[model samples]
Target: MAESRSCDEVLKAAFPSIVQKDEVQKEFSHFLVSKDLLPAITRYLHTQPGLHGRLTLLWAVDNRPTRNTYGLHYLFTLEPSHRWMLLSAELAGNDRLFPSITPHIHAAQWYEREIRDMFGLIPQGHPDLRRLVRHEHWPKGTHPLKKDFLWDHVLGRQQGEHHFRRIEGEGVFEVPVGPIHAGIIEPGHFRFSVAGEPIMQLELHHFWTHRGVEKLFEQQTLTAAVPLAERVSGDTTIGHSLAYCQAVESLLHLEVPRRGRYLRSLFLELERLHNHLGDVGAICNDTAYALPHAHCSRMKEQIMQLNDRLTGSRFLRGVTRVGGVAIDLTAAQLAEIVAEMDRIEQDFSELESIIAHNASLIDRLETTGVLTERTAWDHAVVGVVGRASGLDQDLRRDRPFAAYDELPVKVVNYRYGDVRARMRVRMDEIHESMRLVREVRLKIPQGPVAGEPSRVAQTGEWALSAVEGWRGEILYMVTAGENGTIQRCKVRDPSFVNWPAIQWAVIGNIIPDFPLINKSFNLSYAGNDL
Candidate 1:
């Protein structure tokens, strides 16, 4: 949007008062602010022209950090022109409270709440510092995401759901929805305070699928842990794999070959097209447009068939490995994928025409569950959700990696940020991904699939990687071995950052529109549960 932040020496000048500023490794830099200096440091970074850089990516990281007194870390991203910035910060483990950045950056709310849930780090003056991803009965002193925490035992210990605070005012009634919902979805509870038919306020309780993925990664070796990353979401398999692979490459000091990069981009675009088709189609189904849903699902079926033929896995698992690709696409396989894409293109064109011209479908989506630009930015939502709001921040174009360097992406921007805006973005992305798929066929490079991964990472090595996923940027952090194994690894899904935006979007709309708005965001409850 703006050219990368100017090189500013003033970041060094402003940050030291908070804590000792230090480089994370030679690869990344961070300013470690003491608890007392955080508010001042946050003010400086947001206002500082020279140092704050383009807030490239923002999510909190939790580890049973043996090195920190509080055993926790908070990260901020600063990049000049989407190229790079250091990504390390500290939250004192002892203070238990840090000033909230929600008032300052607006994008930091869910990130702060999630960190608090995972590591028990309290943020002072958080406008809405409610529990986000943890159960209500989840013990106070025993956060399951910590280094030596229990999962099954904690659930066993908790009785029925924690009783919520009651309101005494007349004509205020509470409606309780399920933690175990009706749909083929995970468990999350929603309590609404409704005066009559209109909802006054809603309180959501999440954390039914708590697998402790982040804490588990810290304990597992990187090579042994790639499977876990792939399962972050069955649909976002390729994106998470790429981020993890890139982080491993940084830890071991290896770069992927040009051909490997090209192939990775090829699979990524294929994955993107397939998911967007299914999602847009599902949205229509929710609005009771069955024909559009059927057409969309059928087209998606063809896409998945193409994926099965080309990659040997419908989801393309094991296609990415450390330092490069795990599998190479043969010439014939690529050709078949290209032909399938052409057929799907025709199918999509007809489908879009039918849905756009249908007045009933149009009325249902035109203005429901609108999220304003201020709410979108303050929450820092991304993917189709952010694109619909007119924040055209796609990492593939802004910070090019893989074959994306060759094929520039024109990000779709819509300012309305409604059901219509999101649907438009998804529809357009399918068109863009189609073009990329063909371009990939025309320029498939030749090379070995992978380099031999090192047995262990040396000490004092860290790498950060961010991939533009179907939903938005997914980030990964890897710290090299302390004793022949990975010291730390952290994964941040865009769903964690964007889930809270749904709350803002549904505020004024009738409860019936909540399903469509939620579908537009399509946040993964399981992905953020970690």
Candidate 2:
């Protein structure tokens, strides 16, 4: 129980010598710091008394052709003031070595490595400098994200190897699973070092299908990129697309119509319902509990079919446009949605009763795959994963995008951070989402479903947009280029940050429980790899 301080108060006391730029936008406040002061500022923001900031994202934008420098942007969330502070630093085109903050900020590890692999800007003192997005076959010097690199540039493969961390001990053996999984799951390699039934260490190698997604956005118009955002993760169509559209809208100073905002909240919850239902069922299936799994699957299918009837797409794609929602819900359609939700909720409650009565399933989940709150905080975990681990911050409730401000989302949190905690969080959230959906349908105002853009985006105008997708917070940072083209569109899927938490979750758990643990914290590979 600690009191909070204002951002200005903390900055004046902690960084009196440091100067911040005056440019502040609706999304966040911008500041330019030197490379040498990067680590100091990050550490202060992360560990300070009231300013315990979480490194939301760390990404680099190639500023070539416009300037002979690369821009490294660090986005931190200060919960006390509910403000996002963006620290930007420039690395000269010729000088690529920038000081790494990963040494002090654990959450910044993968982000810095990604910048190195994509932009060729090395974090001078990072412990693990190995390829993050780029694999060994990718030629050493071919950094695809540099502004000079063409989107279609093809490179020849070269012989190389990736070294995974090895644990050497008596009776400690390695279990390597999947760059190719047996199921229809996406490609990701998991290396587990187990000491006779208990996991000691787990190393993950993902991004097998890095599509150079960010690079593809460079020359595309803002409107044209909506479909691309929808496909960032097939499951999170509304989440990704809404975030991207909002970023564009922010830059253009456009406001979505009231009805459009309400419909958005409805669609987002529908997306959450289907995904969470599938995940709950998948978790049960992994534990040999087939009845609830089957029931959950049926419920999920019902919601998806409902989505198609309402939005014309099963995954709810093409429904979110730049200014607002593309589709509208009529009075009859709204009533239909309510009736459908009632049936599903009743069925889900019955299933939940069965699940709660089952002793064996509870035993299997209780202490399995525990990701401590401290670890969750260190990694900047989000959404269901973070909520399960007692990091009680939800963008829907905290930041309030779409219709969330009016709807008043109830954030679900659990401190155990176990498989059961994660499962319970999802279960509670399912009920909350259902309530929100019903409320949105009830009080939706009569207005346009979409809004027109106020004006064209000026070059260099940028904004950050976040939507609390089913999995977690989906962040889209879009910077306008010449003639309203996208200079850079950075997409940070929840999976990108949550994937690393799985390594900690698996420790002390046996190999047999890995599937259950993973399913409980279901993450998107396409979203992360993108």
Q: Highest lDDT among the candidates is held by which one?
A: 2
467-486, model 1: which lDDT tens digit per residue? 99888998887776676456
For each of the candidates, the C-alpha root-mean-square deviation to the true structure, in angstroms, is 3.2, 1.7
Highest TM-score against the true fold, candidate: 2
Among all windows of 10 consecutive residues in model 1, the one with the lowest summed lDDT is 1-10
Instruction: Please give the lDDT score at residue 297 for candidate 2.
Output: 92
User: TM-score for all predictions?
Assistant: 0.90, 0.98
Q: How many Å off is the CA of 131 in candidate 1?
A: 3.7
Clash count per candidate: 4, 0
Candidate models: Cα lDDT each: 0.74, 0.90
Give the Cα error of residue 24 in candidate 2, in Å: 2.4
